[model samples]
Target: MYSSIELENVEPRELEEEAPTLLSVGRELKPEKMRPNVWHYERGEENAYHRQGEQEELYVVLEGTVDVTIERDDERDVITLSKHDVLVVPPESWRQLRAVEESRVLAVGAPNVPDDGMLEE
Candidate 1:
């Protein structure tokens, strides 16, 4: 049986050493309710790198504003999201985002296993 569901103050961690950065929170710390190898990510930055692969992805804006670009099935679209806005991308789609203003975005997906995601390069 699970002991607790409370992950008190689930603070973001740093890179390499977990210095309290957002990547850590996004990369690690999967809640019990989520899928195994789930990807729960939060970006508090001005820009994000582009990536694509076999898994699908969803993005949720927490504050401010951001723009997401997606490519799939020979179609391309740019989506702008404000606080509380959400966007979903299908598997095999390429995507990237840019912060129009200081922003926080939550990105979630499944099978975030190492081999499921890829970079264009």
Candidate 2:
């Protein structure tokens, strides 16, 4: 789904040192129930898998492209997303993002509160 201009004003933060190199433009729009925050992850030499607890996400590709594997419904699906591509992740979905090319994205969802629910280690 497309985001409304009013609701899309949220900006994404760059999370390099910890992640990779990329631009994220919607750092705020996280859901109330999940604790919302946004950040962008760039492509690294290595790939990683990640998931958030009980919360869903809408990742809209704002620049470049990336290869992704989304694990859901007891299965794994691979897809390549590029500019303007929007991906919706259902609750409890497991996902891995690998930069097939370079990529930039917008992560909009809850911040994953309760501390234990976020993808941070």
Candidate 3:
């Protein structure tokens, strides 16, 4: 069971219009072995501010440290994660990811509601 692309191999696409470091990989590497999931984001950025609407998400910090801020209901919280650390964001909670240094982050979410993720305005 292997479906892989060097995440970094994703060529220049319309996504470069969004962010040079953002690569839309979930569709291109859909694994037949697993249920469809909302796109998996392979990000190499200093920070990313966004959130999921209908699905909870797991943030896997592959390198460096990331400050995760989640805003829900009327409260907000922040967590610091380093290499190998993982943070789970519940549905509808607003989240912001800021890398303390050059970093790689893989965000995974289940049951593809492909259109449910929205970036902050």
Q: Which candidate leads in TM-score?
A: 3
What Cα-based lDDT does every candidate model obtain? Answer: 0.56, 0.58, 0.64
- Per-residue lDDT for 1-121 in model 3, tens only? 6677776676534443243255546766874432222222234443346666777777787767767888988798888888899777887888877666666667777656654768777
Worst 10 residues of 3 by lDDT: 33-42
Residue-wise C-alpha lDDT for candidate 2, range 2-119, written one tens digit per residue = 3323434544333434455322323233334543333344454223466767557777777778777888768989998888998888657778676655565665555554533345
lDDT of model 1, residue 63: 67
Clashes of each: 5, 16, 0
* RMSD of each predicted structure: 5.0, 5.5, 4.2
Pitting candidate 2 against candidate 3, the one with the higher lDDT is 3
Candidate 1 regions off by >4 Å?
1-21, 26-28, 31-49
Give the candidate number with the greatest lDDT. Answer: 3
Better of 1 and 2 by lDDT: 2
Candidate 1 clashing pairs, residues 3+ apart or interchain: 13-21, 14-18, 14-19, 14-20, 14-21
Estimate candidate 2's alpha-carbon lDDT, on a 0 to 1 scale. 0.58
C-alpha-based local distance difference test score of model 3: 0.64
